[model samples]
Target: MNDWLLAPTLQGRTLRLESLSEVHAARLLRHLDEETTRYLSRGAPADLSVESVAGYLRALNAVPNRVNWAVVTNDGDVAGRISYSEVRPADRWVEIGTMLTTPFRGTTVNPEAKLLLLERAFEVLGANRVHFKVDSRNERSLRAMAKLGAVREGTLRRYQVRPDGFARDSVMFSILAEEWPAVREGLRERVDAALR
Candidate 1:
């Protein structure tokens, strides 16, 4: 666990965000469907197992300057996971990422979960910026970032190597501290509309 930051349980109208643990492994493992795994760096998750996922979640605790959360729905089902990494306390910034199941993709969970995370980063943690990096081919994630009102700061070509040894581009997006109010309100409106 990092001294500067610890994962906090964040609540929203439609869902809850709690620090991820092995207890969530089975449900999170089930979220590893083809549609949801394709865009991820691991790509299709060939050898994924509950134990492997549990270990993965376990290892996350030792990662410096990063925090992970399991998104739980009102129904008590595990929706997926969201995390912010590349956290620089001195710089007061973080890069957020998500891996939600296909079922929750277009629902209130995404925005409200993001609302909670962004709220923590900006309002609670005193971060000046929160950024995202989406695989260029992942249109769904790209759209999510745009919908969140983050500015697209261009792409980094061939930024990461995929599990299959293929290179992929990453689209950069960020929200500055000055822009949080508008983005937070937009997310709230979307979340509220989805809840209704």
Candidate 2:
């Protein structure tokens, strides 16, 4: 088994990324309710009851190679969830994703989380690649990836079906080892700007 597949907790300021737990059930419910599932590939419902959300979180936590983390704000609010999944140690790759609440959107939270994850994946975990797959129609995510210097590799047609029963194309983006130095610098600059 690839070591990168090991689900691990990564922490950051304005966020505490711990492995997904049953304790996050309520927070997860709050998050899924704040966003529409139409643009989310993970298919989280917009209105999940506490029990239902707990069940969902438990199920997801049971999955291997998936480290789900609750994104806690500086105010100690559970703002959203993010994860590094499908870790392929042999290929030195991982996928980072999240369903951030509107309050956290377009904020430094997303990029800072990604930066921390990348630092761990590449510097600590010896990863060579980090991939981000987004719904082609999600302009926000695409724009964010572009800002981070992730190159658009290509599109996967009809990659999956959304909750609305429509086919969704996936836009694949990645930052490889050779490109990490520059990308890292670029991301650092962006995060620093947000701090200023």
Q: Please list the residue runs of candidate 2 whose C-alpha ends up more than 4 Å from where it truly belongs after superposition.
A: 34-36, 162-164
After superposition, which runs of candidate 1 have C-alpha atoms over 4 Å from their true positions? 1-4, 42-48
lDDT of 1 by residue, 1-196 (tens): 2533788788888889999999998988766677877777645444579887777677765677778899999788899888886788888899888889888888898898899999988988888999998999998888888888999999999998987898999999999999999999999999878768
TM-score of candidate 1 to 2 decimals: 0.92
Candidate 2: how large is its RMSD?
Answer: 2.1
Candidate 2 residues 1-196, lDDT tens each? 4556554767765566666667877865665553434577756643568877776677667767777777776667776777785677776788887677776777878877787788888888887889989999888888888888998999999998876688899999998888888987877887788888
C-alpha TM-score for every candidate: 0.92, 0.88
Question: Least accurate stretch of 10 residues (summed lDDT) in model 1?
Answer: 39-48
Best by TM-score: 1
Backbone collision tally, model 1? 0
| Candidate 1, position 142, lDDT | 89
The CA-based lDDT of model 1 is what?
Answer: 0.85
